[model samples]
Target: MRKEFDLQLDSFMLHCDAKHLSKKTLKSYDQTLRLFAKYLDVELGITDASKVKSSHIRLYIRYLRARGKYTVASSDKGLKVNYPDRREDYKKDISDTTIANYTRNIKVFFNFLKGEREIKENPMDTIEKIKPKRRQKQLLTPDELKLLFHSFDLTKFHEYRTWLQCRLILDSGIRAGECCGLKPEDIDFRSKSILVRDTKNGKERYVFFGHKMSTDLRRWLQYKDRFSDSPYIFPTVRGTQLEVNNFKLSVRNAGKSVGLEVFPHLLRNNFAKYYLIEGNGDFVTLSRLLGHSSVEVTQKAYLDFTDKEIGKKYQRHSPLNNLNI
Candidate 1:
């Protein structure tokens, strides 16, 4: 027999599916709801959403903070063999950001239940919002950037493709998934722009590239044609679309080779930082190019520039420096 909580979760997931939410979003909702349901069942012997209260949710939040990652298995199938060499530090407390995400997901689930009139009272109605502490953004120096780029062995086909993909993200500020979804037809050489179809918010937008990137892209296309006729601009050895995680791992390994920590998103972040600080670009245009829903979202992510970065930007835009006395 199915539990009442599982039944309600299934209904909510069906609603989400009807709305055409992304797979990643659906996965998040499923994971968060299932984990909460498990906690409610085991800890409080509560198997129904209608019986849940705000106090129970608060206890769950505290429990999450005290629990360690990978210590509890969602299933017993792989409990014995998973992560045999788990380090002591791997059992550390969960971060505020992760807990905040869980809180948000739980709130959304309760809201859905309330909207559907499935529950008498919303347990999350009185729960306070979780705000994660913002960490300072780190930018790569010029020499470090150069070292990272040179770490890729461009003679190999996969490495060459990765190198060009990294350069494209640095030049265009496109997300890793967006980069992976690119096709040859998406590139407009004449306009030096790419039509990005797959985006986080399900909106399509155009992102531009520099002359140097355009030249490199053209060379890459010609070289790629000599080997594989893949549908995607960046494809696997078997001519399949490259997965985002695989690309992230490739970038991470490349950075490790050069003794630096890096990822595809870091390249995108650097692109935004450079555009605003060094290129004298405006947030409005950058936000549009980066496919941000709003300029405010873009600012919230990149506005925390360091003091030296602010001074450098001011030096370039200083009125006294530009005007002759």
Candidate 2:
């Protein structure tokens, strides 16, 4: 029989399942732990978690860093078979963000082990969480956004829905997933607020739209009802809920037609920035509007303002400029 420490990972997975974690998150945790187990076996020849030490974990981190991209076949099932065949051509280096996520999953697994008293000492005690650099996302100018809106061929059903969805995202900074998952009934026409049932954090929130977006959405709904009996506000030709990737591709292609490279998230970023700068730097309200856990997270992700933008904001808020002193 496998020892308690040896089967600790299985126990942890069961714990995750009981907590009702998303399938995607559970898969990531399983895959990361499998790779760590493989590292322990091949390098340190340790089969028991109790025998694993902080030093061994450090060695594995270095091993991950030294390994080239694609070289580390996902020790996870199904992907494991192609590892030996594709190892030679694995030249892309693992990104720091990906490495950080892997480290996080490892930490979570070991933390579970400690909590269950499966191990006397925690191997992750000395391991510090890696903070990856935040990449700045591009935002579209007002003119660019206007041009993108016009680029859509409104006559086509898909294009019309895509155009309306883009406007909705810009008006309310709900995530792409949340937008695509919306049903016709989710929108409270009288309140002009959408009830977001599906979100990344698994918590429901409300996202509000402006007058212009409300008008467009109402018109789209009327038009959409004539063609499809789908429950979703935006549906495929077959009247099924629109796939997120298909929605993104539709938006991306429209941007290309207008000589711009826009994506759904960019519109979200644009919304946040516009809300902050034009709406008098209301970070608290913006945080709630974007459905972030906290204002700090919202700041950390979106506080990267250019000097020109800052100057523009300053001109509006300058007491002397407003007072004409």
Candidate 3:
């Protein structure tokens, strides 16, 4: 009556699918569990979920740290490295953040197995969650932002669209994925807000922009109608929906032209930082605007303000500094 690890993993995946998890999330769980299964077979010659112990899970974490980017091929589950040369090129150690993610996924899987009565004792019960160190988020400076925006050639529709798109993200604090998912019907010009129907968590919310962004959107929409009658706010030249990855690449290249490192999410981060530090925005409203589950989640992500940013915020609110004493 030995329960196989692979069987348990498959059952867990089916459960995840039933819960209507995102494809990206399902794929991540699949890859992580497959790797775990490979470890169970190759390292301990233990394929049964019932036989797994907390010590084995700890050893796997250590192995992840030592192996770096190297992983055994799940097909054969052999201990040998898959691509030796490729590992040399990206020789950085496996990040604690990645390990923590893997640990979380594994815990979820074990919890599922226990609920299904597949495992009597969940080995991951005692395994503590890995708390990754939060690195200070780097944002684009005013000069860099100016340079990046100016680098775009307005003559080209694609560049014009990209510029507008970047500005929209910075102004609205919307996720890039949600931005790409926007449609013509989503814009509420009267309210100066967008109806993000395809949000990350599947909940609809409104994200607002100022007069400047609204003006730009109107102009872009008028220009866009001349060439293509696509439903999407930002569409490919062929009038198809613009892919998120391609948009990200365009953002990256634009930053490179200005001799600055940037990405789509950086713009969103800048939105949060600017809203909080400069606009004197509160966390509860900011959290809802960012479409996070709660204000606490928003606070955790953005609480790490640099000393300079803190000093600027303090100057605005300091009683002795603000009021003549």
Candidate 4:
């Protein structure tokens, strides 16, 4: 008797949980697999994991490409309440990037099923990986940064904390989640570096800062000590670890106030861009600092510099220009 799709999915999720994957990753896998299971049951009446075929998977991909966002809900209850503004992009097509992600999640799930001996053959093995068009990463300008930073009300504790978080990301190229996970003990004043314990890859690494950031960090620490004794370096007023979403919202609103579009990740992106283009830094050092698995990953991300940025980099390294010929 072949195992039911939902039952095998539950077992796979359990295995993933035991491996200590990040909450975001776990949620993605769960959501994608559940949706795929639902599609299989409704479209093909196939509930057994072993009965799924490559043709069924290809049909599902076509279905995904043809579908619109928010067209399907896990349950029928409160559909109107959940999506109140149906007029607002109710029929917008799902992006290629999202479809690719769903396909990847499905492939991972099928691979797990095969590995666990739940299925003799992986249905997704024959399915080609969906390649989405790479979108250019937007770099924040210096003028925009100045405006966004100044928009924050430094007198307020929450705003001050968020301002410092933004500064840390821009100065050190640390992710927003890593910034939220910081503890006072992680900071090494002597070395001007931070020990990032909670990272995307689950590996600990050191990210450095400069003298200006050092001074600001000291002042922030002194002020924070006077008010709260939260274990995290940056904490909410209730003395709890600040959530990444809250920090993201704060940064977004700050940008809105200054009439510019900004997000926490953009700050980190600017850090990498400037580190290479302006600071004349190399890929290997930046890769290690950013805690990438390898130099290739870092290069793939930061190598999409615009023509103007390339020209600026070229001018600095122009051999004849520097040789005074």
Candidate 5:
């Protein structure tokens, strides 16, 4: 339960719930709003929403930066649970992408209050996020891929099942949620295609794989047939939809055995990078396959090509490289 000191928070949360936002979005907005309340308690000494000001809201943002809340972790997923950061360590920092989200939500909250005549001015109206620097995409190399695949035992049931899971992600580039949500009905054997329904951004699309993925999926399901039955193409040990955390644990174990990286994010990144380079880096098809809403989003996420490979491209991206990136 949230603390009851702030009326603005109570009203804001009520409005958000009335709007019926998704759970993921609800959690995010709730966290940002809680931070705002904490900021109010620290700086403004105002508990009531009616007393909030443009100045207080602006100061809240400044407070976040001052506390290193806006700093991206030195590495993603840096710290573990049950550990406290030293005074110098501070809050485990969020990424620029994350900071942008918080800023956007805060703006919306203040705007809503303004619309309701609860505030004289919207302090978040003019605040902007620090644009994140373009970071290089991390993808597995050919040898690394070999290491990942060949490291596992094909004869073992659990090992084979995990292999199929990794293969599907690398080949399809489907979101992690889509992977868990997939059902047997989603695939058509004759068509040799899979239809992912209502994926990220609520777009449905069909993706087909060549012999490698199709054959692996079929073979693995055959092995799994003796153990249990479930509608899900990939089911948990108890025959229900597999949870995301379980999948991650299996992938990490497989990677340790293979002496290669095999996490979901890396596999997904490799999928995009390979498809782009193999298809002459066409963003439109790549975007669709990856379930990205726009070509720009795809471009911004994947940048794993070697300098020599990038230089060979006909289109120059920068003066230094004689091409555009």
Candidate 6:
């Protein structure tokens, strides 16, 4: 947001505001464009937005490729950050996933500039998106889910927090950040649900919990006297709401206790897959529950996961037809 940049990202912000775009979307745009500006300043010596061109964007991509991930970014204007000394040599160049995300953001900005006549055209139009390689979705087995659940006890204080944390993540199928962002009042116990605000698409949705979780939650609420001053359901000993980094450690530690390696998203995927299977592969219901904008997004992750292979076996084992044999 500083003045030293060439591209006035302000143009993109105004266009987005006029269109009534959500705050999260606008923030993402602001993030990518600002980082683009920083990259330009550090690598290309460009300061003016009007002179921005396709090649500069291309050069930026190259820099990202050469620098790669694990490469510690130098502090802007000589500030220092303590990043661990770990880096991987990216000899193969930029990853498709990285390029795809960058391309998507810059395309948004360039297209906005074109629409406003601030630029002649969207420079990224001719450039093809880097196709990401196919990745298999990993679903935790049912035993894994059981192991995860049985890992913690609600009787002890530390175990109770872990129990509450995993229970919310699994039952609600919410992102780890959303779960930690939760406050006690956000839960509608009478309705057996919790509000997940600004989920993936900046959409607020209610996720219902199971009977067991609702009960465990009540017992945990008894201990709510501890975090009364803070708004988050889970807070630190010091009484502040939890942050992402702290949540990562807490979630990881909870995972360690269960003898099951779990990440927050894996629990979410378990929620989706189980529901879809139980619903007999119902896409519409699953999509709404997970707060995905489209069923296709839900399908993309769970379709393969729930496809039934036993239909042929049922037909092969039909007893009525066997009587004729």
Best by lDDT: 1
Best by TM-score: 1
* Candidate structures ordered by TM-score, highest first: 1, 4, 3, 2, 6, 5
Candidates' lDDT values, in order? Answer: 0.89, 0.83, 0.88, 0.89, 0.71, 0.69
Quantify how close model 3 is to the true structure by its C-alpha RMSD in Å: 3.9
- Residue pairs with backbone atoms closer than 3 Å in model 5 (clashes): 316-323, 316-324, 317-323, 317-324, 318-323
Per-candidate TM equals 0.92, 0.81, 0.86, 0.89, 0.74, 0.79
- The TM-score of predicted model 1 comes to 0.92
Ranked by lDDT, the better of candidates 1 and 6 is: 1
Local error of candidate 2 at 47, Å? 5.7
Off by over 4 Å in 6: 1-7, 11-27, 70-95, 149-159, 253-261, 279-281, 306-325
Candidate 6 lDDT tens digits, 158-208: 556656777677777787777777888889889998888756667788888
RMSD of each: 2.3, 4.0, 3.9, 3.0, 6.4, 4.5
Clashing pairs in 2: 69-92
Q: Give lDDT tens digits, candidate 4, residues 1-325.
A: 5448878888989999898887778888987887888888898998877898999989998998787877875556646557624645576888889999998998888889888887888888888888888777787888888988899889999999999999999999999999998999999999999999988877889999999999999999999999998999999998899989789989988998888878998899899999999999999999988889999999998899999899999999999989967
Instruction: Report how far off residue 45 is in candidate 2 (Å).
Output: 5.9
lDDT of 5 by residue, 12-48 (tens): 7788888766455676777777666666765677666
Give the poorly placed runs of model 2, Cα more than 4 Å off: 1-7, 22-24, 27-31, 34-52, 63-91, 256-259
> Which regions in candidate 4 have their CA more than 4 angstroms from the true location?
1-3, 70-92
Candidates sorted on lDDT, descending:
1, 4, 3, 2, 5, 6
Clashing pairs in 6: 6-47, 6-48, 6-49
Put down candidate 1 lDDT per residue, 146-265, tens digits, no spaces: 999999889999999999999999999999989998999999999999999877777789999999999999999998888889999999888899988789989999999989989999
Off by over 4 Å in 1: 76-89
Task: Write the residue-wise lDDT of candidate 2 on 64-170 in tens digits.
Answer: 88886655544455566545445433666667898899888887887788887777777887887778887776767889989999998899999999999999898
